[model samples]
Target: MSAANLYLERPALTPAAEDLREEVRTFIAEQRDSGALPPPERIGLGFDVDMTQRIADRGWIGLTWPRQYGGQERSALERYVMNEELLAASVPVGAHWVADRQSGPVLLKFGTEEQKRFYLPQIASGNCYFCIGMSEPESGSDLASLKTRADRVAGGWRINGRKIWTTNAHRVHYMIALARTSPAEGARHAGISQLIIDLKAPGVTVTPIISMAGEHDFNEVLLEDVLVPDEALIGTEGNGWNQVSAELAYERSGPERWLSSFRLISELVDVLGADTQPSTQEELGRLISHLLALRQLSLAVAGMIEQGKSPNIEASIVKDLGTKFEQEAVRVARNIASAEDLVGNGRAPRLRALLMHAQQYAPAFTIRGGTNEILRGIIARGIGLR
Candidate 1:
C-alpha cells in the first residue's frame, strides 16, 4: 500500500493528450494577459460571447466532430485532454460546452443531412447554441413520466409543455426537447420523440430564475403550440428515450465532474503556500487521490465512447464519485482558512475569486446534471439491485 503502488496502477494520459495539454496551457497564458480572457468569475460560469468565439476560432470547440461539420475530426481522448485543460484553467466555455460534448455528436449519429448542415457548422463557429429540454415540471429524473405532447400538424408538429431547470435556455437559440408523441401504450418509456425546437419560435416563452448566487443561468421555457418543421425531429420517433440515455453517458462522465473546483484547488495550494503542514498535506493528498481515481474511471469511459460504445453504468459511478470529490474540496477549503481570512483572501486574486465562487456553487455540483440519488439508483439497477 505504498504511494508508488497507487501511482503505478494509475492510468497514464495518452500521448495525444500530453501534447495537446501543453498547447492549451500556452494558449490560456496568452489569453490571460491580453485581457482577452474574462475575469475568474467568468472563467467557469461567466457569459462571455467574444471569448467563446475566440476559443472556437482556435478550432478547439468541437475537436471530435466530423470534418464535414467544420470539426478537426480528432480522437475523443484528445478532446478529453483538451476539455481537461480548458476546465483546469476555468475558461468561458459555456457557449460551446453542450454542443461539443453531447448535442453535435448525437446529431451526427442520428440527425438528417439537413440538420447536420444547419447546426454543426454553426456550432463549430460558436454561433449556434442549444439548451437541454429534458426536464419538465413533473418529470425530472423520471423522464418517461414527462407530459410534454407533440401533435402532428400539417408541415410539422405542434409542441406544448413547460420545461423547468432549463439551463441557459434564455440565451440559447434552440433546445433539444423530448416530447411525448403518442399516449403511453405498452410501456412507460415508449412513443417519445426528440425535436430541435427554436427557442425564438412564435409560441416559445422563456423566463429566468435567479439562483442563490444571483445568477440567472437557469430558466423555465413554455412551449405553447410551437410549430417545428419535420426536419427538426432528431434520431427517430419513439427512440428519444434510448438516444438520451446513451447521450447521458457522455454528459455524466468527464473531467468536469471532478475538476469543477479546480480553481479552489489552485487557491488552496497557493494560500497554504508550498510549505504547508503535514495535516494539510494529508487532506490535499486525499483529494488528489480521489481526483486520480475519477480520472482513470473517466478515461476508461472516454475510451468506450471513442470505440462507439455506451458505458452508461460506468459513467454513473464516475460522476457520482467525482462530484463528491469536488464537494470535498469545497468543504475543506472553508476549514483550511478562517472565516475572516476567507473573505479577506487576497493571497492570489484569481484563486481567491475561484474559492469564493466554489463556496457559492458547490451545492449544485451534484444536483444540476443529475442528483446523487438518481445516479446511485441507476448504478444499483445496473448491478441487479432490483
Candidate 2:
C-alpha cells in the first residue's frame, strides 16, 4: 500500500453499538454509587478485581468473540463504544484489560481448540488475568533482538531469560511470552515462538519496579529453567514474531492509548468557564479537535478488525498520534490549571491530585507498547518510505 491508501476510512457505528453506550454508562454510575468505582486521583486504567468481575457479570469482556467461547458475539464497534464510555468515566479496567483486549483474541485466532476451551471462558468470566512479556532489559522496541530462550525438553520447554518493564506481571495470573526456540539462521525475526507462562511457577520470579509515579504497575520478571508443558506453546513454532506483531496492534490501537490522561482534561473542563482567556479557549479547542479526529481514526481501525482485517499500519498511526496527544493533554491541563488557579485552592482537590499524577505519568506516554520512533518506522515501512 502507498501513502495515498494509508488513511483509514472512518466507520459509522451501528445503532445497536450506539445503544450499548447507555448500558455501559449505567453500569459505571452504579459502580460509582456503590463506592466500587471512586473518583480517581490519578489517570490510568486502574487494577480492581471486583470491578473487573462486575464488568464481566455484564458480559462486557470478549464482546466480539463467538458465543461458544463465552462472548456476546457483538461487533467490534460496539466494544469500542463500550470502552470509550468506560475510560471516559475512569473505570478501573486494568485487571482484565490485556486478556480481553488481545490474549483472548489471539487465542481465538491461533490457538488450538483445547487451548481456547481452557483459556477463553476463564478470561471472559474475569477469573484469569494476563500480562505481556515482550520487552527485555536492553531490547527496547527491537523485539526481534530479545534474549529470552525456550529450549525443547521432555514433555515441555524450559524457558530462561528476563523480561523487563512487564506491566502487571506481579498481579496477573499468566504471561504470553516470546522466546527463541531455534537458531536465527540469518533471520533475526525468525526462530521465535510464543509461550504461555504461569507467573507462580517455581523458576519464575517477579520483582516490582516502582514507577516514578510511585506505582507498582511495572515489574522485572525472571525465568530460570521454568518449564511449561508443550501445549503451552501458542500457534506454530518459530512464528512468534508475527503473533507478537499482531498482538501489538491490539495493544496500540485502544482507547487506553489516548484516554489515559482524559480525567485530567475533563477536570480542566469543569473549572474553565466562559470568562476564561481566549488563548486557553483556543488551546482547549485545538486539543478537543485532535481528540475527535483520533477517535475517528481509532474507530476505523475497529472497523477493520470487525471485517477480519489486520490494520497494523493504521493502528500504529493511531497509537503514535494518540500517545503524543496524551502528553500534550498533560501540558495543556497544567497551563490551564495554573491560569485558573485551580490547584491548592481546596475547591478542586481531585483535579489537583490528578494533575500531579498526570505530570508524573506523562513521560511514559510515547514509550509503552512501542516507542514513537519504532511506530514511525512501522508507518514508514507501510507507506514504502523504508
Candidate RMSDs in order: 3.6, 1.4
lDDT scores in order: 0.81, 0.91
Best prediction by lDDT: 2
Q: In model 2, what are the clashing residue pairs, if there are any?
A: none
Report the lDDT tens digits of candidate 2 across residue range 184-239.
78999999999999999999999999999989899999999999999999999999
Residue-pair clashes per prediction, in order, are 0, 0
TM-score of 1: 0.92
**Candidate 1 lDDT tens digits, 126-236:** 898888999988998787899999999998999999999888898888899999999999998889999999988899999998877567889989999899998889989
Top TM-score: which candidate number? 2
TM-score of each: 0.92, 0.97
Worst 10 residues of 2 by lDDT: 1-10
- True-vs-predicted CA distance for residue 268, candidate 1, Å: 1.6
